[model samples]
Target chain A: MMKGADPDAPRLWREGDRLHVDVRGLCCPEPLVAVLRLIDGGEAGDGLVAHVSQEPLLLYPELNARGWRYRLVAPRGDDEVALEMSRPRA
Target chain B: MTLFLASARSRLLPASVPFRFFAIAAALHVALWVALIFAAGEFTQFRGGVGHALGAAHLLTVGVLTMTAVGAAMQLLPVATTRPLAAVWPTKTVFCLLAPGALALIFGMFAAHVGAMIAGATACAAGLLLFAGLLADNLRRASSMPLVRAYGWAAFVALVLLLALGFALALDNSLGFLADHAGLALVHMILGAFGFMGLLALGLSHVLVPMFALSSAPKGRVAWAGFALAAATVAAAIIGALLGLPSVLAGACGLGFAAALLHLWLMRATLKSGMRKRLGLSFVLVRVAWAALALTPLFGLAALAGWGPGGTLFGLVALGGWLMTFLFAILQRIAPFLASMHVSRTGGGPALLSDFSAAAPLKVHACCHFAALAGLALAIVLDNAPLAALAACVGLAGALAFGLFLAGIVKTLASGKI
Candidate 1:
């Protein structure tokens, strides 16, 4: 289970080897903080995916700082996006 | 994926776009205090007219406040709205027109040159209208953040009225057409300070304060109610000033006080619930600005009651104490934050926020700034010119320290030390 995960928070689940987060309706920093929590809490798996409504521009810097790489995994919709992220290999 | 990346990149404008405005605002912040030093003799007695005092006021209003607001909005709005600006050229054109226009306007005021004042006002009005058009287009397209959008629209309306009144005031300097020039001038100040800038500040706070604190935004009925009351307050205040009715003005102040309390409560809750503790010195300044904001209406009421330099004190607190202080607080954070983003985007690796911030100068600035505000307030109470001049000198020192803080950022970036 994710550390200090709130049941009422945005949906997060695991499937196979990947952790998935859905933060579609959340506002800025909320969406960003959700992902950062997963990363900082050491809950993010080798493969992680996030579904977000906005592009999460502010998140890119934090990801960069943490040595994570992400790429769009789904075709962009008008308001939906899915990004596949991975930890940098040691 | 490539298209997505491109779209994301488009949300952030070129570094030069926002930085130009930030740089100008920094320089003018220093200039404002210097101008105030010369105008200190008139600080207490100043009712409404053109002179060094007015020049200094415009420097803060047009040069620093609006200049910074335009730049930040152009850069941040695209990101927040999830839409890119139609083009960058218009943003550049706004800076070109508004910057020189502001300088000319201040010069004209200081020298009492009606011709220069008219020309400057015209250019400024043109520049602001163009910016307003851009804001409206973005707001029209925005699908999310309805609360911010509502505030943005209200502020937009206020800006339009402010510009029209501003231009008329400039013309009246020569033509003298208006019957109640001074009253209209007071209305112009209220619309500009509280209406346009105040609403924008309150609206942006919903986004900015949360983002900085790493907290969730404030929303729901309370936030909306706060907005409604604030809008009502501005409307009532304008009508009151225009009609020369003290009761209406008092009612406006009461509305404004309620709105301020609600705003402070919202902010306090936001901060308390935030994950990030110890938000650094910028937050200290932000808190002070909030305090100043809360006191503004009380000062206005006192002014109406003819209490102890209340009118001048109210103006000072409203403009310098609340707006200018709040602006500098945010500017310190965003300027470096944006620079870090740009640095990372340009393949400069992850540039830490600390790398671009110099704590020493900022500490000096904070101390001197608070001291200067206190000194100036005391000076106003006593109606002492030399003391006011001395306080302004302290303010100038603080401004210069702030400038050094900014300069350090540029140096770090230029030297590739980050």
Candidate 2:
């Protein structure tokens, strides 16, 4: 069924002090909602991806505020989004 | 299938409407704020770097304020119109061009390099053009909500006018269109603040504050006064600039803004009075912003009344005192709310909204935010750099911690099926 989202090719890639979450191809409540969960778990303050397709692109700031360094990466394909997040001091 | 297609079409054209630009713009806002703190540090109180000040102002206006308004409008348009944006490219285009351009301009200003500034401003203008085109297309079909609708109309017109003025200013700095500078400066400030940000803030706050604070909607007559006053001020200011009048128009514009703020104050007090009990950080933000708004026109009136150093402090009051403080509070709540909303929930998942990171951090942030803002206002009025920076750094701490809050929320979400 599901390919488990490419472990080696993390749709969400994380290096020390950075976390990226790809919520692309999704819509409003979804993008914001997902990011909130991460912040609730204390993943904010550096860079983090709340990546999604164009649908949720405008609502990315919720990611930045919680401390996940926020970067919006829209892959050319309609299906993929890369949210690149980093912490300020790691 | 047909129903789905119709809904999609309604939202896509001219970009999704309830105004989502605020989202993108918000990031830009903070980025600029951070940049300014670092960049402005090099210059002493009277270092006299005209370009530096101008560039920083642009970052605040274009990068921070406009971006947020744009995003917010797009997001809210659907709620207002039951429709979506036409094309997606416009939003992407605006951001893609703007982010880098703003960087370049700010860099140019710091380095005293006109060429970089010109190049950067051009990119920003291109981004703004796309924004205008998309806004115009949306305005033709945007909702019938009077306040929101009028803003759409004004935003389109203002976007075009602002871009043209920005370009001229950029060139003038290089080739010297010195005489036009003062007039254009007035026009630019009027359009940037009063036209775009002011209108958007006035209109959106009607929906936003109520939603966040659980207050009742604004009464019609009061809102109309605000709308009319904001419109009159912009119009008068624009005309005044053209004719070189006795700054009376600007003074009158100040009065108009006061009228608008007063109406909002009435609406706010109504909300506060009706509250069964005080609530979260978001509501705290709602309350604090009013204080900032109160200062805005007080300073405006002081300017009108010819109080000394009123001009200097007014900027502090409006930009730092009002907009920044208000925005931070909203962000704290929205950040968590939006994050939780975006989580891919399982049917059996814990309700994420209820499980947010503790209110303690928010309370801490609030204290820091207010202190920083107070310090900044004092620093500006007193012209104290160290004081301003110290205050800003604290605000930055709260802001940075606010940024950190995202992670806490994520952990809560992923920790379990919740």
Candidate 3:
């Protein structure tokens, strides 16, 4: 799990075989930073989904460099944008 | 955790490349003022020939604007496109060729040496053509940022036209083959200033302004229309000038005004709604530049009307008031920002932007810059050489102050001090 430095940091949760980060209402670099934190925390297995209002373009290069792949996940409910990323199982 | 974490660094270039270009630009900034100071006597009456006025004009055009454009574009283009430049050597080579080439061209213009001018022009064209090639390749790959890409493409086209006309103008100096030397020269200036560098600056503003201000980026539809209008304006202006159509040229100015208005509205609205309540003194300079941009078309109209000193007013406002002012404002912010980004790449914690920035020098610069602009405008109105010379000194002081600000950033980076 990613640690939060602020009380208002994005909420994080886990659902079967996936970690979901809700970065709604947060600005750019914040969502990207949250995703990075998840990756650095070793919690990013094969299924990490980030919900953000803005497209996390900055994260794409980092994700690719780390052997991770991502695709946009159409919003369900109030999520403006959801990006799903994973490293393929060996 | 420290306040700053090293951000993702995939597309970022080795810091040295952009820094070298910037350093050269800063040095040339001082050189430009020095040239202006020397040419002040001839400044008002200078209708363009091989002299200090002409040399100084080239120094600012090639030396400062184009030099900074290349450097900033190389670094920022990748960021906008989310892809790294395919190769680096071409970029470094551009700097190598352009830096000396600008100096030689300026010197040649000063001395009226045809051989030196030819060699310098050849070198500059080679450097610019290579840069255009690199820009085209990168822009081609950028499918995501549509508005930015569109602006880039338009700017690229304008650059090609400018280069073609620029070469013709240079050759005409010696060969005397062309009948309409003045006509072609007018086209060359219009394309270089409003077409190439102008578009590039406008495009980059779309990216940089929102990012720095922490504002939402402008809506796509409005920005797209603005870009279209700007491109149309450039086309109309070039065609009008080439065909000797004054009314069509005025129409182009009208289009330019519409585009400028739209751009300013978007920027102003963004700034107003920004998360940042106080965007610092840099925005003050930016606002001033916007005002100057708004006046440029009006000044162009005045020039067309055969008003007193209209040509001089138009040139000063367009080049010095709008472009130069806006560039310095953005560069003030970008230099430290890039420095911080680079410092974070190293092992240590990233330097705070506030620590690296020295406010006093920026304040000094702002005051002096505005004074120089006003004084020069007044000098033209009065046809006073000494006043123009004095204004150049003020402008030079402002440039030096900016240099000190840059030096402060370097010192902060070197010492690794808070």
Best by DockQ: 1
lDDT of 3 by residue, B245-351 (tens): 99998999899999999999989887886555587888898899999988999998998998878888888888888888888888888777667654532444434
Q: What local distance difference test score does each model get?
A: 0.86, 0.59, 0.79
Tell me which of candidates 1 and 2 scores higher on lDDT. 1
At residue B256, give the lDDT of candidate 2.
Answer: 62
Model 1 chain B weakest 10-residue run by lDDT: B1-10
Per TM-score, the best of the predicted structures is 1
Docking class of 1: acceptable
Clashing pairs in 1: none
Which should have the higher DockQ, number 1 or number 3? 1
Q: Which stretches of candidate 2 lie over 4 Å from their true place?
A: A1-90, B1-49, B214-216, B269-279, B304-308, B356-361, B406-418
lDDT of 3 at B86: 85
- TM-score per candidate, chains pooled: 0.93, 0.70, 0.83
DockQ pick, better of 2 and 3:
3
DockQ of each: 0.32, 0.02, 0.06
Candidate 1's C-alpha runs over 4 A off are A1-9, A41-47, A64-75, A86-90, B1-9, B344-348, B411-417
